[model samples]
Target: MINAFGALRPDQPIHVFTKASRWLLDRTITVPVTIVEQAVDSGAIQRDSLQLDVPATLASAAQFEAGADEAAVALAREFRARHVQVAVCDAPPMPCTAAHLAGVPAVVLANFTWDWIFEDFIAEHPAFAELPARLGVRYARADAAWRLPMHGGFGTVRTVLDFPWIARRSRRGRAELRRLIGAGDARPLVLISFGGYGVANMALAHHAGAPYRLVLSGGAEHSPTDAPPDALHLDRERLDALGLRYEDLVAAVDVVASKPGYGIVSECVANGAALLYTDRGRFREYPVMVDEMPQVLPCRHIANASLASDRWDEEVAGLLAQPRPEIRPLVNGADVAAGMISAML
Candidate 1:
């Protein structure tokens, strides 16, 4: 447990993470996080590079795309025996519950949907109180010295955008984006995407028949092979670069249809893209993660999925016509995390 600890985000902005994790690594822990398609290995914890995932993540990605399955008692039993340890993992309702049942020493869940659903369960049980819409890493010493409700450590970083990357905008993304969005095919452009691939799929499906043309940003982890004929898929290979020089594809589009990851929100705000969000269950900070005042202006989320509704279109159009606000990105999450770490050490 001396090297470092990691409960990495499986479906998140890779560039943002590489940068954020480095801040701590350069100043504190030396070991780095190892992430593959869905599997992630944190710095040495219990064993060399101990994996912090709950039982479900090891079961293969297909069976539990939305969340982990609880029905399989055998799988759960085996996963718990191997994975049981002080760790942090974004366990939605079912899998997290399974991990708790299986007897993990400490669990830190990153996202929210299952957090809310299982809040009572975690809090009431005395084993899972650490997860309460809280971010950063959550854990206790082998003897339970640190407890739940801890916000962060080291340096506090609120908006993930502060960590720049070398990602570039694709040539296609550079084109003036125009899409039909509204009651008629003559409407303007409206794009939708979450920082991750799964959220992008939700946006495309939500506005399948809308008059607007949508552009979806895809990363190496995700692509446009199966995308609708009308949707434009853009490459994000440039994100791995060091300078963080990136294109403003969302800015050219009329309205953005996507989940607002903390970094994505700032990037969209930086680009001046009109945002129309579909809130994923637990990642509420996506919309509010920014400290910049203007970031709030262009961003918005629908209460439900209903593109055809006249009111929905009106709301979108109204925001599009309004003047945009200007604001700088916020930074605090990593600082808070660093401080927490100091206390823990």
Candidate 2:
């Protein structure tokens, strides 16, 4: 999983880039990590076979150029000097450089939950188009590029790997919530956030008679300040791939109304829930950027708010009225990923 929100600085609170990257790393096999984020250098950490985070002893902080090629090269050299094998890297700051310089292949991919139902969106994105030369420098797998036409430009397909499917961990904090409206009767529950923009969506939730849960993830720059009902509190936990936050909720919620950011949508699709979006546009936090964005969600691409759009609300209501669908294990992007990584190694 490669995170970019720390670089793009989106308006919402969620860190899509880091979330996606960690999710992939979680489902896959053991791979040492040296995270190079803009303005910070998180020391190296060892991973487990199941990709779970065990206690990691940190080294002295090293200098890394923010989003610079030199930083990547420096890290690679450090790895070589220490005789350490660098398995994977997140976007920018040298995963590509490490692959190019070290002769290891880089599998560039967006996290699974983010890209699920949006019309093979990888082809519509910019990173896929821009990273090829860097990729071709040695061996590389543009993870979802071939499947998602939006991620690439006109080019021949190379390796195909599935990035990990990261479900949300919203349910963990559910018990902590106090109570906003003391049971406003019965209404649909919607989770809303413009991804670290700090937009307070309680009004929308209130209007729709739905309770919304806001997730403040990662070490974001500006945390969400506005408050919703105490019943709806903050969930500030780091959820790796094994977490069942999304799996549990998707099995329970009416509709997953969110901005068409990749991870959330992918989770909705895998969970078998209908999706509704307030609108559509560019999200710097989005790991994969696509031009023909509408095609991203083959299931539902909503322009107006679910509360505002009659057809969308009708659709949502229809979904809620039916018996809840059983949530099942979704696509194993990491296994596809493991195959790609193994081929490269």
Candidate with maximal TM-score: 2
> Lowest lDDT 10-mer window, candidate 2?
49-58
Instruction: Quote model 1's TM-score.
Output: 0.42
Off by over 4 Å in 1: 1-121, 130-187, 199-211, 218-230, 235-246, 283-295, 307-312, 326-345
Q: TM-score for each prediction? A: 0.42, 0.50
Q: Model 1 residue 187 lDDT?
A: 52
Native-to-model Cα distance after best TM-score fit, residue 76 in candidate 1, in Å: 31
Quote the lDDT for 332 in model 1: 31
lDDT tens per residue, model 1, 1-345: 223123232222111112234433343343443422222222111111111233222222223322333432443474455543333333222333344455553233232233333343343344444443331221211112221111122111122211221111223332333321111245566654543333322222334565566665555344433455666555444322311123355555677765444444544654656667654543223333433324345655565355323335565767677777644343233343333433442
Tens digits of per-residue lDDT, candidate 2, 1-345, equal: 222321232321221123335544443322334433332234323231112121221111112322435656765565466443323433332344554566544444443211122123236543333333432432233322323222332132255543445333333332222122122334555444344333433223333222333333323333333433433323334323334343445434446655555556655655455565554433323334333332333233444444332334555555455554344444444345434443443
